[model samples]
Target: MRDTVIYAHRGLNHAAPENTLAAFAAASRSGVTWIETDTDILADGTAVIMHDSRTDRTTNRSGSIYDLTTSDLDTIDAGSWFSGDFVGERVPTLRELVSFLGPHDLNLNLELKGNTQGRDRSIRLVETVLEELRRLRPGTRVLISSFSPLLLAEVHRRTDAYELAWLVDKGTIGEDWRSVMELCGATALHPSTAVVSNRCVVEEIRRAGFGVNVWTVNSVQEANKLVNWGCTGIITDIADQMVEAGRRR
Candidate 1:
C-alpha cells in the first residue's frame, strides 16, 4: 500500500493554538511534512491565516474578520484562548506564514474561507491569496481548497500552478460530485470524515484518478481505515500521534 500523507490540521493544534506560528512550528518540529491551515482576506486586503469569518473564537478580541485590518490584528491575542503558554501569539499573515515555512521542507494546504458578502469579495480574496503565494520559494508544494465553488472556479480561472481541491461536507457533497469536481478543475476532493465513512466512496473517487483527502480525523483506527481505502491524505489535529502511528504501520 502507498503511504498516506498526514497533514497537521491547523498545525499540531492540540499542542499549540490553531493557525499561529507557534502551532505551525510545533508541527514542523514533530516531523510533519504537510500543514493544513485556513486563510481569509482582511479589511485592508491583506490575507491572514484564520479559520473563521469572525475572530471571536480564536482571538482575545471579538469582531468580524472583515471589519478588522492588518493593524487591528496586531493587538489581538490569537493563542491565549487555547492556553496561557501562547498568550502573546499573533495571527500570522499569509505572507508571514509563507516566509516562515520557506526554509523548511513543508507543503501547505491553504483552505480559502469564503466571503459571506458575495462573489466579488470571494474573487478578491482569491486574488489576494494568490499574490501572497507568489513569494513562496521555488519547488514549494501548495494546494488551494475551498468549500465555495465560486472561489475554486476563480482559482482555476486565474492560474493552474497549484493543485486545487474542493472541500465538502456530507450535506454539500451531492451525487454529482464528479461533475462538480470537473467544473472546478479540482485535482482532489477534501471531504469530511462523515462523508467518507462509506468506504466504497473512497474507492470510487480513487478509481476515477482523483485524490481523496479527509479532514479532522483524530483517531488512529479511523486514520488507518481511510489510508487502507486509498486515501491520499489525512488532515488531523494530532499530528505527533498520527506520524508515530504511520511509522509503526
Candidate 2:
C-alpha cells in the first residue's frame, strides 16, 4: 500500500486554538507536512483564516467576520479559550499563513467559506486568496475546497492554476459525489468519513481519477481502515498519533 498522507485539520486544533498560528506551528512541529484550514474575508476585504462566519466560538470577542475589519480582528484573543499556554494568539490572515507555510514543505488544503452575499463577493474572495498565494514562495502546493458549488465553480472558471476539491457530507451528495466533482471541475474529493465507509467507494473515486481525502478521522482503527482502502489522505485533529499510525502501517 502507498503511504497515506496525514493532514492536520485546522493545524492540530487539539494542541492550540483552531486556525491560529500557534496551532499551525504545533502541527508542523509534530512533523505533519500537510494542513487543512478554512478561509473567510473581513470587512475590508482582507482574507483571514477562520472556520466560522462568526468569531463568537473561537475568540474572546463576538462578531461576524464580515462585520469586523482587519484591525478589529487583530485585537481579538483567539487562543485563550483553548488553553492558558496559547493566550493572546491572534487569528492569522491568509497572506500571513502563506508566508508562514512558505518556508516549510507543507501542502495547504484551504477551504473557502461560502459567500452568501453575492457572486461578485465570492469571486473577489477567490481572487484575494490567489493573490496572497502568489506572494508566497514558488511551488507551494494548495488545494482549494468548498461546500459552496457556486464559489468552487467560480474559482475553477477563474483559474486552472490550483487544484480544487468538492466537499461533501453523507446526507448531501453522498451517492451523487461524481456529479458534484464534475459540476465544480474538482480534481479531488473531500468527503465526510461516512461517505467513504465503503471501500468500494474509495476505489470508485480512485478509478474516476480523483483523490479521496477523508475528514475528521480521529481514531487509529478508522484511520487504518481508510488508508488500507486506498485513501490519499486523512484530515485529523490528532496529527501526532495519526503520523505514528501511518508509520506503523
Candidate number of the best lDDT: 1
Provide the overall lDDT of each model, using Cα atoms, as 2-decimal numbers.
0.90, 0.86
Candidate 1 residue 15 C-alpha distance from true site, Å: 0.6
Model 2: per-residue Cα lDDT over 1-249, one tens digit each: 127878899998898899988888888888888899999788788999999998899999886888888888668999899989888899899988998996766779999998765767777898898888887677778899998876888888878888898888887675667887888889888889988879998999999999999998989788888888889989899988888766665
Would you estimate the TM-scores of all the predictions? 0.97, 0.95
- Total clashes, candidate 1? 0
- Residue 130 error for model 1, in Å? 0.7
Model 1 lDDT per residue over 179-211, tens place: 989899899999999989888999999998899
